[model samples]
Target chain A: MARIEINQSLCKGCALCTLLCPEELIKIGNQINENGYFYAVFTENGSCKGCALCAKICPDVAIEVWK
Target chain B: MSEKKIFSRPKTLKDAPFHFCPGCHHGIAHRMVAEAIDKYSLREKTIGVASVGCSVFLYDYFDVDVIEAPHGRAAAVATGVKRARKDKIVFSYQGDGDLASIGIAETVHTANRGENITIIFINNTVYGMTGGQLAPTTLLGQKTTTSPYGRDFMQDGYPIRMTEILATLEGTAFAARVAFTTPKNINMAKKAIEKAFQFQKEEMGFTFVEILSACPTNWGLNSIDSMKRVEEEMIPYFPLGIFKERKAADVL
Candidate 1:
């Protein structure tokens, strides 16, 4: 199993990670962060392959993945 | 279960959050630069010159010494820093407006002199910090605050291709243009940055890497659409590749 963490405060809700994730586990959530951006959240943690594509494509570096 | 950290932030980058808009490529570029610095263990020896623009507060992000230069004067300031301390690694982070328009002379002259410094040029097409205005590298027919009806080739002349222009100078050691639209492109851009920094470490002549970045806020596009704009529109005008690479024998 892999683990993914996103710093909510730093996430800008760009959703680039959501679009790039091969597993489609990341998504823009309705809940807003302190910065007011909707922010990205994992939909199915078990489905994450830990490819780190989301972290790699994230311009904000808000996502971290561990395998 | 013992958890080994598989991914984490680069030590060279501070823990503070970036002030750049969401989806802005500056953060990615900063990460790549910091990674390179960490890989080469140059955190203490590197001195970055930040030009006037959105990245003016670059000093706060990088753990190394960073000096703020007047708008478009980063190359000149970096040149002076390198000369004063030849043992130290020097780099300048500049935007399109800072390098191509205001600091064109300094950038060109510094490269012509073969100064051992690296330049990371971020070309987001428009002036991102001071509002979206037509920049020197703004694509023809692209609209901005200043060019309300789109950038007219007749009035705007044409988008300035600084990488191509700099490659012609004999003093330049390496010059390339790269984009950051997809995962593959981001990896390529990181390699290009690494090569540029490596060239400087080897005491090679001036090196430059022009990164075609995204400005979603100013471009009036969503983050995803802005990335599409870079690949679809910007790449056609600003082709990505190493325009010049001086071999060991070619170096003076």
Candidate 2:
């Protein structure tokens, strides 16, 4: 099992993670964040491979992965 | 089971949010440089020269001793700093407009002199800070504020390839061009930056890493489209690779 956490405050809703996630578990949420952007939310079904691709591509450095 | 944190913000970077545009790649380049600084434990002994342009806020994002240099004079300023404090690791963060256009003389001379320093050059084709003006590295047929009719070879000339040009100089120890269009490329960019710093640590000579970044707001495209443009348009003209790598210092 793997997990990833995204800091909503720092995310600018670029959606690069959603495009890069291999499992396609991350998506832009309907609810807008305080920063006025739709932040990405991970679908927590324990399918994350923890490859850290999203974290690597994130310009904001908002994603943190645990394996 | 104990969980391990795989990736997080680098310590050398300030906790404050980046002031770049929504889809700007300056944040990514800033993070890469910060990560490299943290990896080398250079926090205590590092000085960063902030150049003019979008990356001028480098001093604000990076938690290091930063000196503000006049437009395109980062290399010259960096040379003075490195010479004054020989023990400190010094680097300059410059954009294409600053490095290739206004500061070409300083940049080329610094590489020719083989000053023991590192330069992180960001090339995004247009001058992002100056309202998408034409830059020295702007691709042919690219439309900018100054070149709204598209850049003509006869008028604007060809886009200068800084990495390839710097590699030809004997004093340059390492010169590589990398882009962050993909995760794999982003990782490789990080490694290139680290390698440049490593060579500087060895007192080899001037090392330079040119990063092809995307400026979404300035390019009049969304974040994803701007990134795609880098892959489709920019990469073709500016091929990414190690242009030069000198293993040993040249005997003067």
Which CAPRI category fits model 2?
Answer: medium
Cα lDDT tens digits, model 1, B178-203, are: 98887788888989999999999998
Query: What's model 2's lDDT at B50?
Result: 96
The model with the greatest DockQ is 2
lDDT of 2 by residue, B187-225 (tens): 789899999999998899999999999999878998889
Model 2 fnat value: 0.69
TM-score of 2: 0.97
The ten-residue window of minimal lDDT in model 2 chain B covers B243-252
Those runs of model 1 whose alpha carbons end farther than 4 Å from true positions after fitting are none
In candidate 2, position B53 carries an lDDT of: 94
Model 2: lDDT of residue A47:
93
- The CAPRI class of candidate 1 is medium
